[model samples]
Target: MFDLICLGHAALDRVYSIAAFPPEPTKLRATQAMEVGGGMAATAAVAAARLGGRVAFWGRVGDDAAGAAVRDGLVAEGIDVRGLRTCQGAVTSTSAVIVDAAGERMIVTHLGEGLDDDPAGLPWPMLAQARAVLVDVRWPAGSLALLRAARAAGVPGVLDVEMMAGAALAELLDATDHAVFSRPGLAEFAPGLPEPDGLAKARAAGAAVPGVTQGEHGYLWLDPAGRARRQPAFAVRAVDTTGAGDAFHGAYALGVARGLEVADCARQGAGAAALKCTRPGTRAGLPDGAALSAFLAERAAAV
Candidate 1:
């Protein structure tokens, strides 16, 4: 049985680092450039696999060089790609990531049409073997369908609710056991509500756990008892924040699968994300089992 199954988008990313945003109609040369495996669910899968969890990734990719790169990257990371399919005529999904020196990024994505196609034909039996399922908002139909199946199979379903329309957001949350939102997603979902209040409101809507990630400030969560807790972010020299959240989600899923308390799970996630930010690229900087254990051990010793 797999520790986690990630069902959503996967793509190849070309990241360019510049000093600042370019001026109107002006072009700026990048200070550095790199290519890596990216996409919300895909990155999280890499994170889990690197952290010692048995992981499976279910997504579609075009039968192109880019798609092959993505597949090869995931397999190299030790993620099971047996559930992944190759679309014959479709173009592979791709992303152009522009990162400023401030560790901020702006992504221009081309989610090829093939990625949105229904994933009903995927290996449901394999998916059912997962301890938990992590999904992203990028593939709404497939994500929801997988969540429903997971629910029926009594597996925990986690929804990484990034910025999406209200209707879609509501539907996604309705199917999610745990709803983890980005800062922008929380603002969009609960217009004027503050973090704690918004989290409470989100829980009232049927989510077992509702949380929002506030970059360096850390994360805030509301438990089943209506109690709220905040975990402080670990101090680190953040070189790139691209896949920080994805790392957090993957670690959090592993924690939950191990039956850790919600608060402890969030702390573990924060630690993983902080470690991820200390380097560059999405998967490039991820910590392995011994590294993560040492990091957490050092934190405990300091405490």
Candidate 2:
């Protein structure tokens, strides 16, 4: 039985570390260039596996070299991807990430046609074995299917809300058990409100635990009983922020599967996200179970 199943968005990333974000639109040298496996559900699955969760990734990639690398990278991390589909005539999702000296990034993405392919053929029985299922906004159809199955199977569903809107976003917010938002995600769906109010709006729609991941500001959530809480972010010198959020989602899924409280889950996720930022590549610095334990312990010692 898997501890978690991640069922949306898979991409291969081409990252270039530059001296600065914009060089006046002129030619500039990259301090480092590398190709890595990325995408919301894909990287989250990697992080969950790294942190000792028995995880699987179910998503689509093109039948190309980049696709092979993306799948192989997940296997290297010990995630089950027997459900990863290869689509013909459809290109894999790809991203070009530019990281500046301050570790912030500008990401330009090309979302291929394959991400929206039908999810009817996915193995629904897998949800019965999972303790939790996590999804991102990239593939709402797949997310819906898996989330429904998760619900029927008595598993918690965690939604990683990004920049999705309209009926799709509304339906997902209602379906998810734990709705975690990117700051922009909350703004996109519940616009013109403060963060707490936006999350309260989402909670009113039936999401049990509505929250937002506020980068350096930490993780914020409205508890099941309508009480607001915050988990302070860990201090770290980031080398790249590209995959930090992905790491957070994956680890938070693990925490939920293990039945941790919402705030404690945020603490666990924050530690994992902080560790991912210490390295250059997307998945290279993701912490394992031992590493995560040590990181949390160190924070306790400091406190």
Candidate 3:
């Protein structure tokens, strides 16, 4: 059985290292540049694989060089990509990311054109073999399909609620078992509400666990019992913030599949994200199982 199945969004990210973002539309020199695979569920799949989860990626790309690179990168990371389809005449998703000296980044993305939105062709039978499934807002139709099926199968469905319209976010919130939102996502979903209140609203909507990932601050969530819980962020010098959130979501999903307690799962996610921030790229920065165990062990020892 697969430990986790990640669906939606896969892209080739072109990263440029610079001193800082310009105040105006002026050209600036990049200190370094590289290309790597990125995307919400895709990166999470890589992270889960690195952390020793038997993972599969289900998404679409184009029949182009960028798409090939994205596919090859995941395959190299040992994630099952049989479900990663390539669409004819479609442009693969691509992003231009500019990271500054402080490791913060600004991204401009082309979400691709001509990619299929129908979920009918997806391998539905595979859900029964998956311990859990993780999906992102980038592909709402597909995510909804998977989330509903996972719900019926009694498999945990983790939703990465990033930036999206309130209506779409609302529909997804009701379908997920674990709804983890980015700061902006929470703000959008429950506008003007405090974090706890926003999460409470999410829980009421249908998710058993409603949580938000606050970079450097930590993870806060309402557990199955409707009690609020928190997991402090692990402190580490950040080399690059890219993919850190992906690492958190991936590790958390893997933890769920392994039947870890909610708090322990949060800790696993925090440690993984912290470790990822210590390195320079996206996938290359994800911690393996051994490294994550050591990091979490050290922290526990210190505590």
Candidate 4:
């Protein structure tokens, strides 16, 4: 049985590093360029695998070279791709990621149209074997299927709430056991509501545990006692901030599978995210279990 199953969004990313963002309309040069594996759930799968979970990725990719790379990259990270499918005559999802000197990035993507949106034929039996199911908003159909299955089987359903329409977010939140949002997502979901109030809103909407990740500011969530809790982000020299949130979600899923308290899970998540920022590529800085523990230990001591 797998520790976790991630069931949405996988892509090949072409990354370019430039000195600054918003370059002139004229031609310019990138300081560095590289190709890497990306997409929300895919990167999270890599993070979970790196953190010692027996993780699996169940996503659709186009039958192309980019698809091959995405599969190979996950295998290199020790992730199980048995459930991943290659769609015939479809282009794999691909992204152009541009990083500036601040380690911040902007991505432009063509979400290839070849992926099948219907998740009714997915391997429900295999999902039943996993301890937890973590999903992204990219594939609403697949996410709903997996989330429902996990809920029915008493497995945790961790939702990565990024940019999505209100209707979609509400539907997913209702089925979500642990709803984690990005800062922008929270703002969009509960516009004008204060952070704590917004988290409360999500919880009231049926999410058992609601939280938000605020980049370097830290992570904020409402505890079971309905109290607001915050975990400060770890300080590090960030080389790229591309996949930090994905890393956080992956670590948090593993933490849940490992039976950690919510607070401890957030800490583990923040640690993984901070470490992810220290490297250039999206997956390059994902920490293993030992490294994560050591980093948490040192930070705890310093605090």
Each prediction's RMSD over C-alphas, in Å, is 1.6, 1.2, 1.0, 1.3
lDDT of 4 by residue, 66-133 (tens): 99999999999888888788888989999999998889999998888778778776777887678888
Residues 11-127, model 1: lDDT tens digits: 999999888876676888998999998988999899889889999999889989999999999999889998788988888889998888877888888987655377768888896
Lowest summed lDDT across 10 adjacent residues in model 1 is found at: 163-172
Give the per-residue lDDT digits (tens) of candidate 2, residues 1-303.
899999888899999998886746778799999999999999999999988899999999888887898899999998988779888877898999999888899888887764446998787777778999999988888888888778877899999998754467878888889998999889997889999999999998878899999999999999867889999999999989899999999999999999898777899999999999999988888999999999999999999
lDDT of 3 by residue, 199-218 (tens): 99988888889999999999
Ranking by lDDT: 3, 4, 2, 1
Ranking by TM-score: 3, 2, 4, 1
Q: Please, what is the TM-score per model?
A: 0.95, 0.97, 0.98, 0.97
Q: How accurate is candidate 4 locally (lDDT)?
A: 0.91
Cα error, candidate 3, residue 85 (Å): 1.4
What TM value does model 4 have?
0.97
List runs of model 2 lying over 4 Å from the truth: 114-116
Most accurate candidate by lDDT: 3
Question: Residue 160 in candidate 3 has what lDDT?
Answer: 93
Superposed by TM-score, candidate 2 places the C-alpha of residue 245 at a distance from the truth, in angstroms, of 0.6
